[model samples]
Target chain A: MSEVIIPNVTRDDRIGSVFNHLFRIIAESEKLEGKVLWNFQDVHFFHPFFVFPFSLYRYELSNKKNVECKGMNDVVQSYFSTIKFFDFMDLREIGDFNNVLKCYKEKSYTPICRFSLSDKNIERMQSIIKDVILQQIKLPINIESHLSYMLGEFVCNMEEHSQGKYGYIFSQYLKKEKSLYLCLADDGISIYSSYIFKEKHLDKIDEYESSALRLAKAGYSSKDRPEAENRGYGISTNSNLLVKGFGGAFFILSGGAFHREEAENNIFIELPKSIRWNGTIILMKIPLSEAKNVNLYKYMER
Target chain B: MKRNTIKLSTLLGENITSRSSLQILCNILKSNDVIDMSDIVFISRSVADELCYFEESYNIMFVGMSDFTRKMLSLVRKNRNKPRKRQEQDSKFVVCDDIETLLSVVSSI
Candidate 1:
């Protein structure tokens, strides 16, 4: 049994480095039949996107090695608590943090949810989101419809494309900023590999940048088979709606690539040298004031 | 030919997240001649994208779609027409038997 210290943890999405470290631990503990202490005493910035890869490796590592996470700051603790990330980590200290946003309660404006591939659950999730939108944001029926559709499309992307057992969604309404953050993540195939099987010339797509760009482009999909209609519009359309249509922010992080959209501009962020994400994460931020009554058609044309 | 009109919201029980509902709609479209997308107050782009598959076989018309849905449908249609480079013969990444295998390999990495 050996304890390892993880220091200088920040909101970095370089998941490869973290995984490499954990894999080293697994390799070290291959013969040991004792719990491995994973000390996080110096963890400062824990990004939400880290949750997906962390959840995946945590389960895998727990099979042979008893991995424990220790010493997290209050902010990191609160963020993890809000999304119940600690539950997946097997950290019993989760009760210490108070989550202000609870899902589905009438008084709560935000939802932190984990759902399965059941239709009833999907309906219930959408209803809760719609309720919050109606109460919190002042937008036309059409704009509301667009947002709802975007939510549905992303969730279905999880159901259809993500080969994972479950999906997670967490949203929060920031009072001071008047922005709503919606994050949906799944432990499934990376976007680059999703298209690799179905399309040709994917080799031209550099894993770090072009993978995210290809997903943001309209009519680019890995679901080009005869059984199901191509699902190119799920990410591409939502990207347009969130950024160009509503003046919000949109991001898709998968594997080592990160794509972000702000207003009319879309940027492909290069992944940090030693980072990789095992699944896909979609994060959207909507400023309710700017999203209302905007002409979505103009953006759709783009 | 009898006109078969299906309201997407009503057919989907106002829940757009369910792909089963899309399958139901696609199944119905196979037997009908016309589909009125007019009553659909809202439609997700993925659903709209699926509707384009029937464009060649069915006489699809939008009777009362709101501006947002109309634009979304047009976007799907327009995007469907764009061209792309064919898949390259030589590959660098490991090609898997299915998406499942590919995902498992990624997680193992």
Candidate 2:
């Protein structure tokens, strides 16, 4: 039996660091036979930041080999289980699993689960956003509208580009930090592949570096017919709202690339390369104060 | 012939998210001679772009939009045509502040 111990992956660490570590672990797991025991002995804290991307990894890995999680303390276990991370990966013997489920049922304001992106689901996500805004930051109803547009554009983009089965969205409000976190993950053709598949000019783009940054350009889209199509503005609009409008940070991980918006110039910084995110992870953090003063109408173009 | 009037916010509800809904509204704008945007509060960029496309087949005039909404529409039109701003300074999209101005503009058209 082969065993792999996962290091502590927490929000305090750079997201790239954790992803690179996971990439190495996944690469190593290929050598092991039978089920790989993924131990979390040193993992004292499991940050919500990694929840969506980790969930995607777990799903993709399950198809390749059996990976069992072990040695999780109550706090780490509860956080993972509460987000239904364990259940989605089909892991067994989750301690206090019922309690974690109870947390979601009780905290209807925050929904952490795997669901397809549809209009009904969009409303559910909007309600979660609305609740987070009201509780953490008092924002106008227009905030709900803005979040809805962003989420809708993201899901619609998934439907158009991701040739995968389902999309995942989860949101949580950090009470202490006075910030709201929203994450959307999908396991499908990533931004790089989508562009390469559709665009003619950049058929030979370096998957590791170029594809991720080009995704931020406003007019650029993966759709085949740009003149006849009103597509390709989803990611740009979301990025605009996050970095330029609300003055928050936007992070996108796709196709072996990590892109973060520079607060100074609003330009995307291509961080060090790691393992490719099979699909894509859109993680956003907006401060409470910014939410209250955000001008959705002013920020968004017609 | 009386120009057609459509309240975007009323037709699509206070917060519009569905792209198809905008398409349906665009259909109404096309079937009519002229469409007015009197009660629109906010429009997503995608939806705004779609409306811009509809302008090719329909005479679109925006009226009664708040400063925020008007600014968004103006920006969307400009951004949509950012590559051809110099050539197309006279964008087909017209925005009137009040119904009186909208009537006068519509009468001229």
Candidate 3:
């Protein structure tokens, strides 16, 4: 397999950089004497910041070729169209999980298992993961529920917020450390846009920094009906699930800012600097022992 | 129990009945056997789109399809393949013709 390394560069036109790499790989594959299986594997740290434009490029490329592209199954394909794009964004988190798994495997760690979301294969993927976890780890029922619930929350947010631009989800298990790392990402309207949409007069405000701060606060939403019951619960619920329940570290990066939940009080503290990205990315770490404590109101103040 | 039936005419109207009928069809497919497409005399593209979503979700196999249904499917496929073009024709008759054949084919499936 050929590998292409993208050098660390300034964040100007990140989308263009990704597309340039993708197109070059496609072009080079076409020139090969036989059918060349191309994998755009080396590009790393590509947050949801570039997923939208990259997906659009992929869609247009597929149309230009006029042949059905098979790699992106239903969940992935939904990210390209307006109908289901927002709903499918969290699926991108799988990409981040896959990357971490690759890193751990290289260090001689054995991963429990992995799966992908395809239109035809979603059932199979879920079964495989469930079977592996049940037989190997013997995870408790409550722990399993916790994991599933968290996963659902992440995936649901992607669908609701990303507007079908781009999203992925991934998980990795490290045997030696007995820990799991999961990441979800989306290239869509950032917290900045969410805030701006709710407060139109704030349009002139520098969104990148302020959006990050607001996201760290509880009971805050970019939605118009914030006062309505259950309006702004996802982030706060997620934070509670991570800190009090799982005793896990939660990191959220959006609108060029990053925030981490403190382990003791579960307070969301802003990171020193913004992340230099246009969208949202979340990384979560869970230890096996603490996974059992995941609960609904662990992090909620009331 | 006999399958709950909704007439094609009632399904076509722009009212709550249309939405309810479509939703009923979707719910039935979730638990029951394959739908008898042959009995379906007429269906709008909107209905077809909903059916496609159900078919995809359940992984339902289209076993029997009438020629009209096939033609409608083909037309839908063809239309999606290229840009939409305005063709002078009677929309009502076209739907009626396709519905009969497609329903027959679907029932067989």
Candidate 4:
């Protein structure tokens, strides 16, 4: 078995380099002359930025003959399924980030699995997280349900509204650290467009920071079809779950605006300068101890 | 009294009427006394499908129909005519061109 290791790479633009390294691993592994051929167990110290390339590689490998990958966590499985869905819809060749953005702008519904878990995937993840919480964290049933629901709802919005390209599903179950990290990201339209595009009178309103804050309060949607049954509860529910339930932090960066909802009630503080990205990324960290009693259904109900 | 006006557009010169437009004519049948449906320009397959669904969902009577709309409805009826299981009953369809004629039919019923 052949192996390639990328050493001490600390640049975000080194995505191509990591891909090259993985490609070499795949090529060598295929031609190895041993029964117990090339294995990826020796892979060490993958940069967080390597997630996208790794996901793409896994997807390609899954389609190849005589190649099978297993033991992936729920997050990785969802990512794999999303890529497969996009490839099935012939969207894998959408080439370039700009083209992805353009397709979203056109609302083409081309079945591109933009970088986030869909609602279906989120619900599935919630069930898995809830079971882990119940068994490991030993939390009350209600608490377990609450946390799971909130997490699912929060992550689902990344797919429902982003209209951008690519989504990320990152999960780590660290035995030593006794913690779990789950993050979902998408490069799509932002909360600013959620308000600005539908409201013609808000054209002069340039204060995106304030706008994002107001939207987070409750009962807000920028969709033109206001008569539709959109209760605008996602942001508010996320706030309650993160702050009141878990005493956690909820951060949102969209449309050149940033807001952090810390472990407090109804107190949202704004940060200076937006992250200036075309999408949203949510990173959630929960101690395995605290997550034990997280009931997603109860959280969603509340 | 009945009055009808038809507007022609595009080279095909075929009249086009949407399901919503047909609903408007249905409303006219319900309200007005005179029947005139000569103004209908065209009816596409989509409109016919919607009308079939609408007939199933609502209790509506055909007032008046142009020869074109009538023929289209007949074609759909003939195509869908089949003996199926009891659970697979087909939806009803009605075709009418003039609101006044439809109203007269409904009033007579």
Candidate 5:
């Protein structure tokens, strides 16, 4: 039996450290065999950006290998429970997820949720999420509508491209900073894998995840369909809106590559050594107050 | 020519992203057909570009657009109508099946 230690991580000023720790886990995760023990004793704080991907990972690992998670302090346990992180690991507790996120114990969050392919019911979740954001946080109508646009475009693109059965998501609104943090992780056809099927992309992107990430940033769609079908503008325009327009941070992690972008700052990309992310994970932090900084028409591709 | 009315909110919702939905509508529409875009707060750039694509085909008219929707629609239209970039036709790079093939090509260089 092998053991993996869950670290205490948060999305703070030291975000580079958070990602480095995440990469270390991915490098280690690929090696585990037989029964595995996951120790959460040191995880005093687990931000969704740091923990939601693992929630999906733990769910996937359960199907193939024996995995057990134990030892969490009250703070870690409450954060996990509030986000419904523990529910993902326990199928019996899931109960089809019909009753999840019913009570908004915390006004600022929506629990970790799985948007399954069979149901195709992201609308209900979107409604609840939008309501939570609007009611609790007083955002300008334009910001509210644009945030809705970002969610619709991002998730619709996910549904169209991923081809994976299930994707996990969670969100939170910070009152003081007036920022909204949203994340979605899917063990699906990653950008690297998606390009393999699209012969049109064969020349544009290398098979390497880094190459795929570059094309993705450059407005290349991974759809195998003809260019006339108009399949790939979602990520490009939305990233511009979030990172460039709102002065927010956008992060995408898949395969061995990771990218982070923000306005008036240098773009960050990491080709982590020996790391293999079986799927894709994205996190966006949008400053609601800065929606005025962006001229919507200016960001759209002409 | 007989004009038809197409309500965007009814076609999708207040916030629209799916462009194919409108593509389907355009097939039944004709030149001068009116698309009612009232009550629509947000439409993605892709969807706006699709509207631009439809303009070349059907030449339909979009009416009842709020200031926001109209601005986005006009921007995409103006941008698409700009002078075109000459097509390179894949002369810039080599096409391969996967990453392994790409690696082989790079190693040879």
Candidate 6:
């Protein structure tokens, strides 16, 4: 059995780097056809960042190799269980229609849930935004509007672009940090893969992920090149609002590229050679204080 | 001019973020109808973009947005009508190929 040791993604480790490291393990082990054992011995604190990526990739890994996750301590397992991480192992969904089960408002973390762009899921997510998210933050209407719009744009983009049947999301309000941590991921055609078809984007393409991320940030859409649908506004506007408007952090890792953004800094870089996310993973930290003062127009109206 | 008023908040509480859905709803209204955004606590950018198209309504007037909502909408309206440059500027990023340079550069902004 091939054993892949899961690293502790604690406060000490740079989250983006840790995530990529974990992803590197999965990407490298995909060719191994035998039983794959995931060791969680090093994990002590269970951060939500690990749940989305591992859950998404673990399922895919299971298809090619018999996957077994062990070494989870009580705390790690409990956190994972609460978020329904194990449930996804068998591809089992808690809600048949569209519900990422909720424990209570007090739990402060919404279980990872699957969604689509269907009208029903849109409504469901709206409810989640208000009840699950807004209620927790208890911000005034201004922040409420931007937060709802930001979250909706990300999810809707996934619905419209991911081309995957179900997009997954998990959000938690970290009271200590006064920030909302949200991660949206999908196992679908990645941004880099989709952009290869665009003739305008081709000449600008680099062997690295710089071109794909730049194109995405620059409002280039693989689907709507010059159409009227405002296809590319989601990533650009939302990133601007988070990093520029709210002083928050926005991150996206897809294929071989990872882009990280904040108010004063923006970095787009290629992941280690041969390390690529088959689909995409987006991790955002919405600073609660700055979000309250966020001016949606500043980012959106451009 | 026949006037019909529709409250966006009634459809989806104080926040209305969906653009295509809002456009579809606006499609059903007459050019003279009044759509109330007053009850709306927040209006998303894309939805506001669609709303800007109603400048003449060819069809309707978006009304009733709170001062904050109105301010947000007005910005979208202002930019939507402004003539945009034919050549879209390329997005700039300080891409770091190596760890030292990446560490030296700001990672995200």
Per-model interface RMSD values are 9.9, 20.0, 28.1, 29.9, 9.1, 5.3
**What's the TM-score of each model vs. the native?**
0.67, 0.72, 0.43, 0.40, 0.79, 0.80
lDDT for B55 in candidate 6 is 49
By summed lDDT, the worst window of 10 consecutive residues in model 5 chain A runs over A89-98
Query: Chain B, candidate 4: TM?
Result: 0.40
Candidate 1, residue B90: how far the Cα is off, in Å? 28
lDDT by residue (A137-184, candidate 2, tens digit) is 443434656676677677666666777566777776666776667787
Q: What lDDT score is found at residue A292 in candidate 1?
A: 58
Q: Is candidate 3 or candidate 6 better by lDDT?
A: 6
lDDT for A213 in candidate 6 is 77
lDDT for each residue of candidate 3 in B33-98, tens digit (9 for 90 to 100): 454465343332323434555555765544345553445344443333233222221111111123
Clashing pairs in 2: A256-A276, A302-B76
DockQ for each of the predicted structures, in order?
A: 0.18, 0.07, 0.01, 0.01, 0.14, 0.24
- Candidate 2 lDDT, B1-109, residue by residue in tens: 6667776665655554445556557555644444456655445565566666676556566667666456655766666644421111111223334334433432332
For residue A209, what is the lDDT in candidate 3?
56
- Mind giving the per-residue lDDT tens digits that candidate 4 earns over A160-236? 45665456544444445444444455656776665555563274345544455455444343431333323344565
Indicate whether candidate 3 or candidate 5 has the larger DockQ.
5
Order the candidates by lDDT, highest first — what do you get?
A: 6, 5, 2, 1, 3, 4
Write model 4 residue lDDT over B1-109, tens digit each, in one string.
Answer: 3433222222112343222334444443332233323434334332444454444445333435666556545544443323211221122212223333323322222
Single out the weakest 10-residue window by summed lDDT for candidate 2 chain A: A89-98
Provide fnat values for all models in the order shown: 0.22, 0.11, 0.00, 0.00, 0.12, 0.16
Best by lDDT: 6
User: Which of the numbered candidates is closest to the native, going by highest TM-score?
Assistant: 6
- In terms of lDDT, the poorest run of 10 residues in model 2 chain B is B84-93
Better of 1 and 3 by lDDT: 1
Per-residue lDDT tens digits for candidate 3, residues A1-302, read 33223322223131122323433444443344433332333333333323433333334344444322334345434333321222222222444534433433333212322222222222223323323343344445445434544554454454445443545554445455565655566656666566665573264445245433444344344442322322244565665667657766666656544455545322222222311344666666666776554454333221
